[model samples]
Target: ETVDGPPGARTYRRTLRLPYGIGIAAVDERPGTATGGRGARPGGWLDARLHLTDPRDLTTAVQRLRRLFDLDADPYAVDARLGADLRLAPLVAARPGLRSPGTADPEELAVRALVGRDRAALLVQRYGKALDAPCGTLTHLFPEPAVLAGAEPGGTLGALTAALADGTLRLDPGADRDAATAALRALPGLDDHTVAVIRTRALGDPDVAPPGTGAPDDWRPWRSYALRHLDVAGEPQPRLARAGR
Candidate 1:
């Protein structure tokens, strides 16, 4: 949830589900006044504060937030690499630190990928754990894999959740990307597109070229960012006659 703050500032509040218990996070953001002079770059800053029920979980919570916001990415190096391609040069110049987003909870992202937004919302409403103290419209934590598995949702969702709950498939941050991709493919009713989305976003693989985009070899290790630039430029390449790796 968001509310107006002091002039030019925006404040956001939300409840977080941590390993031990629920926590709350608040962030205040405003434009950087230091960047207003002639030839100064346009930029802003934010102050993020977290309240945890268990102080021992502080490290884990901070690490999760880093992944959620892609803060560990080395933007300068990524920009240098991707800027070499003329196709992506302009985009790189426009957004120097563009990052491929990572998930705070990989399992949650996988479930959402299997079931689109509408169905996911329904699942959340039905199975999500209510917060001890609700914050604005955010009243519940996303349903856990065990809860969804017990519900025994029909078809692909059921299979996926069961695998996640039982460890047949792992989408955790430390999971091996190739193994996770193979496991996802073995599941019935999961298409290549869905698997690719899971592998790239949920698994945090930065080099994935979705099957058939004809991504060049030069984009290696950074193809995901290149793909985003192509998509934003409305210049997606046609499916290659031979599929891409």
Candidate 2:
């Protein structure tokens, strides 16, 4: 849920499902000014605040927030490496410190990835857990894997949910990236692109270059950020140019 704020700032507030209970997460974002040239700041910064029902969950909440915002990334290093690439050089220069987003809830992201937003909304309406108090339009927590698993959504979604519910697939922040990728690959009906999406966004693997995009090998460990640069620049292909071209 979002609320209009003074001038350029926007405030978004929502209820976050925590291990103990629910917490309110709020963010106030303001777009940065363009100063022009190579060093220009292209994006905005946000201020986040969390109201937790159980203070004991503060550490977990903070960690989740960090992942959600990609705060753990070293943008300067990433920029230096990606900016050296002729194909991504201009984009890196334009949007320095740009981050590849990570999910607040891995299971939720996985479900959304498979079902798309519309079907996920329907699932939310039907199975989402109601908050004791709604935060703006955010009245329910995203349905848990156990709940959705029991709902018996058929086909790929059902299989994915069941795996998540029973721990056949682990998407938690601490889960092993390679193992999870293999597990996702083993599931029928999950294409390479979908698995890559889950690995990059849900598991927070920064190096995955989506299947068959022919991403350069040098983009290792930052391929996800490279892909984000292309996405922001609206380039369908990497189209890397020779170094001196």
Candidate 3:
């Protein structure tokens, strides 16, 4: 979908794997050619992806995405409750707003998160054009905190990046969700959004609040999964840009 708004109005799209007997729907502003834009480039954008088990639910999922961005929207009725497959990507091109990349390696998305806007520009600048030297780096989900911690200001990563890097402060695999949240909260510069990313990715809790917000109690243990449901069922979307990646 082509989402226009703010100075950074973004476009999103998704790649579909239409399998027989299964339903699938995806929307993107421009799934192709997004990666080739960013840093000194004016059209840099972030790409997000969501998949549903039912194909008839595409309209519902697209609506939630619109509402998440604060556009006046209404969605259809659908019941998609799978989360393990939702994929989100951001195209950090040097542009005013961002566009989504079709389907890319999770690692590239991870690097985009590690090196945010200001710093990502610097990284691109450091390469002295071509935005190369690390154009397509990929690694595991929930990247090493230290990797983000090492980012240079505005040029490497964004604010509160350090807290995300702290080993003790970050949530790792199989960690206690509550304790992880507390630790993240203790970090002086830890932003509400970063903390939420830690909660969901590190702990795999899915209970992490979007940005600084909290999830409904009834959605516990599968909040992330529930989010996909709402996203596909045309339910209200959460304000997540402020929370996690």
Candidate 4:
């Protein structure tokens, strides 16, 4: 349970990348109750307040939040598809409601792919935008591609930033996957693995099988979810064998 806002209440808060600017939102998780031998019913409503730098970005902010949390996914459908695979059936049974997590801003994910987490922290410390009203540890908005582009965030980073800043590269959730993959491949210093990762996490492509697993054709359109289940079940994922460990 979360520990902010009020006693006996759990609140989750985070910074979001809106179209015009950045935003911070706080949402409370209301408890669920079982209805007399029936399943539990969600109690609280999805009430969230977004504090944005620009008031006009409300719509964009909401859209970004939905993408960030992957609220659009149909868990039942995904589980059913992956559960059809014999090897994955058992794992799917073990975890009936697994959902793939996605990022709000594709550009930020691309930058993250280029610079590892440690370096990302350092970059944030040095260059990220400070929120007007800081919420606990939510001190800053991630550095934007334009901001990083101006700072010359190294070679591969530089190319990525330039592309992102100028719109040469698009990572929006609705962006064409094939085109995005091809564009990423054209950039210097990017490998197929990195591109695949971007496809999975940033774009929220549910069917991304890591390069060279020869994942069967049947797993199409939901392989990313399968990969997550395999990882959780300690099954061998040969495509990302070393990294998965």
Candidate 5:
């Protein structure tokens, strides 16, 4: 969505998955000079502002944004540990600080995991709430679990939404990782692969091993990044990029 303004001042805007309440984040895409341009590589810049419904949501909002950008990770420590491994050393050398991308909304991600991209998009278009003011092509806040529960209440999507809406299964960052994984696995129709995706993306557990892939011991607490590095055959994607978001 583009916020209305003067030329060269257009801002891409969207509703966020805030803790206390729904919020809007407007991000300016224009590049800017860094603190030290000399010896600095070229990169894109974003000037972002968040408008929240409540003042108390600030802390959670900031944390979510950090997770969204994978900013809180200590890349030096992660690289030091993983770069020593024979399998990942060269990849780590090639890409100094790889990070695992996290999600802003866990429940939404869980639903998308089951329904696939096109169906998820259709679900958003069908049930999402329209913004008070539209922003270019972005106009809806992806439907919350409760909303989706009412929209679909019998199939796998319904079961997942019901679990999410009632808090029977918690996928938040603060949720207990092992317990949440178990609970998600116990849910009807949710397989190990789906649970693993939730653990990696939703819960932000960087060390989560894939369903059957064996990870080295040194990759602990950062195996998710290592898995991502392996997924690309040593060429990892940028940290800020979301996978098909």
Candidate 6:
């Protein structure tokens, strides 16, 4: 039951629940303060954001949030662990230098550079534009391989359809990222740009190799996402130091 409360700041959104259970809420609280400015906020069962301070903690947060939202009949300890595991801001402060910049239009760079303007334009118009809505921000959920694979010879959806028709661009979720990147690179008509797009955005791999490209220095785990940053920032994608490593 909510109908406006104290004459204070911040529009507190509260979800009532059993006393011992967690009552979900969010406030537009001021930085370092419990009070927040009064403003209407969207309400839902969940809210998420990348803190950008530490990668390991952020990854742990993702795992914990997953369990928190897991609706199985299992006991609530799963969610409690998430709460307990929530690392304080100070602890993360010491562990900075994580999560570099990210992508703008990885697809655009990949399509235009590798696939050529005409074909890339068609592919972007067909699948690239609508990818975000359906696939969300998750790179692994990019459009199907068949469509992209046949994007050239068949038009936009043509390559995709062809890939689907023939078994060349298998859309199996179980496909390995490295193998998928290799397979995408092997498919006909695909140049560096297009293959990189498939590997980084489609396959959710940051370490995809550009065709006939240069050295591959290690950026450790954030390779693909980091490449995405380079692509988005209009900077050249980083070269992999070791070939095929």
Tell me, by TM-score, which candidate is best.
2
Candidate number with greatest lDDT: 2
The list of candidate 2 runs beyond 4 A from truth reads: 1-8, 32-45, 239-245
Evaluate all candidate structures by whole-model CA lDDT and list the values in order.
0.79, 0.84, 0.39, 0.79, 0.77, 0.39
**Error of model 6, residue 41, in angstroms:** 6.9
TM per candidate comes to 0.85, 0.87, 0.36, 0.82, 0.79, 0.37
Query: How good is model 5 by TM-score?
Result: 0.79
**Tens-place lDDT digits, model 6, residues 1-245:** 12233443343332212113222223332223234456644332334443322343544434333322331212233222222322212222322222222122233333444545576445545664232222122212223344565554555434534654576554333457666556556656665666665555444443544565442344334344334334444667444466474
TM-score-better candidate, 2 vs 3: 2
Residue-wise lDDT of candidate 4 within 45-70, one digit each (tens)? 44677888899899887877677666
Candidate 6 regions exceeding 4 Å error are 1-160, 209-216, 231-245
Once fitted onto the true fold, the runs of candidate 5 whose alpha carbons sit more than 4 angstroms away are: 1-13, 17-21, 26-47, 51-56, 233-245
Candidate 2 residue pairs in backbone clash: none
Prediction 2 TM-score vs. true? 0.87
- Candidate 1 residues lying further than 4 Å off, grouped into runs, are 1-14, 27-46, 232-238, 241-245
lDDT, candidate 1, 1-245, per-residue tens: 24556765677665567888777777665454444778654553356788888987788877766776677877778888889988789988876777787766789889888899888888889999888777777777889898998896668988899999999999878889889999999999999989988888888888888777778888878888778776767876535776469
Measured over all alpha carbons after superposition, the RMSD of each candidate to the real structure, in angstroms, is 4.0, 5.1, 15.9, 4.7, 7.1, 14.7
lDDT of 5 at 75: 88
- In model 4, the Cα lDDT at residue 200 comes to 88
Please list all clashing residue pairs in model 1, or write none if there are none.
none
